[model samples]
Target chain A: SAVISQKPSRDICQRGTSLTIQCQVDSQVTMMFWYRQQPGQSLTLIATANQGSEATYESGFVIDKFPISRPNLTFSTLTVSNMSPEDSSIYLCSVEQTGGNNEQFFGPGTRLTVL
Target chain B: LAKTTQPISMDSYEGQEVNITCSHNNIATNDYITWYQQFPSQGPRFIIQGYKTKVTNEVASLFIPADRKSSTLSLPRVSLSDTAVYYCLVGGPPGAGSYQLTFGKGTKLSVIP
Candidate 1:
């Protein structure tokens, strides 16, 4: 089991503004992913953070809206730009452990509320 | 990626064994079946994973048939605290660069006293 943590456990931000969430892992991981969960909805993959390269965004997500950075293996950041009420959701960071199965471990999650 | 199908919700009594089945008819040969449990306002936690036959862990057991088209997650003697949304994912193991995990609606397991 990997120990994961996220900054700003819960935050209330104004609309049209932006918020950057941070994810930290105790051990180095091969791949890091960001997810968004709207109210009463399942988790949606936002992007895959690649170390030393550009992140891979999902189909519905775009780089202009959600930019990801993974400078190292243990840390990554996700920025939600031009936030709106629809963007109020739980954002999570997940990592696929080395030498482990396809199981992905997730952080505690950052709750973002846009007003 | 193989699309998964599962019940939207399931009701069970305390101390009863609950089995939630997930169907993935288009699963690939290299794809493995995995389950995760998620409580409200938290991240999903890995429960079990299996390729074929049955795999058991301290938390739960995964049962996959030889065809690999479907799998079952059995929770024995569930308690109220065990109520959560259970997710079934079918994908290959890591080391393939980036494999996005697509989660379905998931089965919301409710344990009633």
Candidate 2:
């Protein structure tokens, strides 16, 4: 298991502002992913942050709205651009191990509430 | 990606065993069943994983039948702390290259004292 941490554990932001969440893993990993959990709902994949490449955004999510950066194996960032009340949700980061079960480890999550 | 179906909620008393079943009719041969637990305001925690038969860890046990279309996650004993949402996901290992997890509406377990 990897120790994962996210910055800005909880924050309140005004509408139209952007918030960038940082995810840091204690060890190197192959794949990093970003997920969003709406209030009282299941998680939705925002994108998969690929090293040295652009992030793969899921359907209904676009790069311009939620840009992601994965510069190296152990770190990644997701920026919610031009936020709105609908964008208020818990953003989480997870890393996939290389071999065996390849179980993913998750960060605590960044809870953002856009006012 | 194989979609999963699970109960929306379950109720159990403390000290009693609990079993949650998940169904994935189109599960691929290489696909594995994984279970996760999530508390309020926290990330999901991996409980167990199995390709077939039974797999047990310190946290929970996964029972997969011969057809591999369904799985059961059995908790030996329940506690109030176990009151949370449980998720069932189906996918192959990272080697599959997708490396993405799809979370359904997990079963909410409420352990009463």
lDDT of 1 by residue, B59-108 (tens): 88889999999999999999999999999998875455435399999999
Which structure among the candidates has the greatest lDDT?
1
Model 1 / residue A39 / CA error / Å: 1.1
Give every candidate's TM-score on chain A: 0.97, 0.97
Candidate 1 backbone collisions, by pair: none
| Per-residue lDDT value at B16 in model 1 | 96
Give DockQ per model, in order.
0.67, 0.68
- Candidate 1 local lDDT, A3-113, one digit each (tens): 999998999999999999999999998789999998888999999887888999989999999999898999999999999999999999999986677779999999999
- What is each candidate's fraction of native interface contacts (fnat)? 0.67, 0.67
In candidate 1, residue A73 scores what lDDT?
A: 92
TM-score of chain B of each: 0.95, 0.95
Give the alpha carbon lDDT tens digit for every residue of A83-107 in model 2. 9999989999998877747578899
Which residue pairs clash within candidate 2? none
